[model samples]
Target: MVLEGLGKSLRDVLGRVNSSSVIDEDLIKDVARELQRALLQADVNVQLVLELTNRIQDRALHEEPPAGRSPKDHVNKIIYEELVGLLDNGEGLELKPQTIMMVGLYGQGKTTSTGKLANYFVKKGFTVGLIGADVYRPAALDQLKQLGEKVNAEVYGEPGEKDAAKIVKNGLSKLSGKKIIIIDTSGRHALEDDLIQELKDIAAVAKPQERILVLDSQVGQQAGPQAEAFHNAVGVTGVILTKMDGTAKGGGALSAVAKTKARIVFIGTGEHIRDLEPFDADRFISRLLGMGDLASLVQIAKEEIGEDEAFEKVAKNMLSGKFTLTDMYQQMQAMTKMGTLQKVMSMIPGMSKMEDKIDYDASQAKLSKYKVILDSMTVNEKDEPTLIKGKRIDRIAAGAGVTGHDVRELLKQYNQSKKMMGSIGKDRKMRKKMMKQMAGMDPNALQDME
Candidate 1:
């Protein structure tokens, strides 16, 4: 959600382009100016902003739209491509066996990101080991130990050990069984000589395949110089932008780091341990432009649900025109695991554009009540909702500690959902059409299905 203002501005500019009857030089220049303004407001470097806007203007005026594609669409596509170019395009760090050393200034969330990186590999079936080489910071080793427990990874640290390189050397031998090893080195309030030398010593002992610099997005364009300093010292291979959820200067950090040798490999989106995500510039831009990021959404669902079979079964049952209350309850549970309704919707292409129209709080409240009501019901009642007559409703409400009216409201919702799903399920032609559309849906038009 960083750079939300920039995203909104970009979307509005694109909307103007969509509304225009014709693509003219004036419109292109205007769009370019608006983009410059937005980028500047987001704390992007002025020089980079000018360069990007100039490229957009040039491409829009000279480039021809592809066959059957409207001029407006071509311009939009150009904008998307150009915007993506302003960020790292390299594939994220590979998932194979590797040792990674985390380096950054103090308070940049280096240790937290180390855990997140380890968690990422752990989820991918890698055996991870964390080395706490940060000897200067009090409780740093303890923090790493706790995070290691959270991710089910082993942590190696030596209490009262002043020599970081020696600790890393011992940790490597101790956690040699781990397929992936991540070393967390000490950080300073600023990148000083001692911190640089300490990192070099640790790197020498660890011989890591990757050195990651965790930069805070709030630092804005200053991230570039800091990243460069780390890269110069010990060859930082990748960067992780932290605190991206609410930073207005994230745009600056992103653009600045893109110019550095160390490309962005991940972004810390929230406080949750699972909120760290691999950074993909294209998908990121898609979301920023209000075009959604279905790939990321699917990835989140896979991570939360842990099985594609569950999704397939739900789809099949929904389309069969007959699904039990248990099925509905399970579906709701899945949604809850996926994330907030607002977050889920924002990933669904044009749905981000409809954020203002949605009553997310009301929807979340209703969902909670529905879940509680469903929980209060008997297994048989859940499987067969028709059994829930007057007495059953009263019993369920009392069990849930809600009014009977709330219980009935839930049933009404279930019936409405059943009717809607049934309409599509009972109609073979409609079902076929939906399947076909989903299989070949244009990424940009994905929200039409909603």
Candidate 2:
């Protein structure tokens, strides 16, 4: 949700281009101005905004559309390419055995990010450990320990140790067998000399493979200077931007960090540990332009739903018109694992534009209640909801601690799904096309079926 306003503004500009009868010099200028305004409003540096918009304007006015591409498509492509170039550093974190040292000012979510980073690696089947060398902040080690517990990673720290270098040495000795070791260093209110020296000492002792600077998204245009200073002091190799879900000025932080030529390794999209995502310029810009990040969606689905056979089974059931309340319940659980409904919607092309029209909170609450109601049902009831009559409905409502009306509403939803699936099943051609689409066999062929 970071830079939501900027995304909307850019999408609006593209919408105007697609709606216009003509793509002319005037339209290009107008688009450039709109983009300039959006970036500036997002707290991006004025000079950088001008530079980018000028490039966009030049390409839009001078470049000819490809043989099959329309003028609008050509201009959109140019904008997308420029935006990608602006953010991408052409580098990524090496996923081999390495020690990562986190450096940043205080209150930048460094400790939390350490946990998220460790979790990310662990999910990739790597053994990870955390070294809490943050001796300045009270209870920092305890916080890291708690997060380590949550992520099922080992945490190393000496409670009364005043020397961070000594703590780092000891942690390394303790967690030497781990594939990835992350050292969480102390931070100050500003980039003070002592903090820099302490980081230097810890780095010397840990001999980390990557030195990452953790930045708060709210830092806005200051991100560039901060990154530069840190890079100059201790040679920062990568950056992590945190609190991206809450900040309107996320564009500023991203652009500023990009300007420093530091590769952004990851971004914290939400508070959940699973909310962290590896930064990919193409996917990030695709989502911003309402084109969806299908790769990320697929990855999350694969993680949540297990093997490919499970999805095939679901597709077969839907095509056979045999979907039950149990299937719906399982789907809801998978969706929850993927993320919030709104997040899932945003990853779907064209659905981001409809976010305002949907009551996400109410829908989420309804989903929670439905799950609880389903939990109260027996296997027979889940497979055959029609078996539940007045008395049975009352029993389920009591068990689920909901009104009878709520149970009826859930049944109504199930009936709708069943009816929809039945219709798809009856249309053999449509069912085949749908299955093909789900299998990612041929999307264009499915569109042709329409």
Off by over 4 Å in 1: 292-450
Q: What TM-score would candidate 2 get against the native?
A: 0.66
Q: Write the residue-wise lDDT of candidate 2 on 288-393 in tens digits.
A: 7654333223333343334333433454566566788887776665554434555555444333324454565665666778889999999999998899879999
Candidate 1: tens digits of C-alpha lDDT, residues 280-368: 77657767875532222343334334545455455566657787888777666655544454554544433333445455565556667
Worst 10 residues of 1 by lDDT: 435-444
Candidate 2, residue 419: Cα displacement in angstroms equals: 12
lDDT of 2 at 257: 70
- Count of residue pairs whose backbone atoms collide, per candidate: 0, 0
Error of 2 at 209 (Å): 1.9
Deviation in Å, model 1, residue 380 alpha carbon: 37
Q: Residue 200 of model 2: what lDDT?
A: 88
RMSD of 2: 12.7
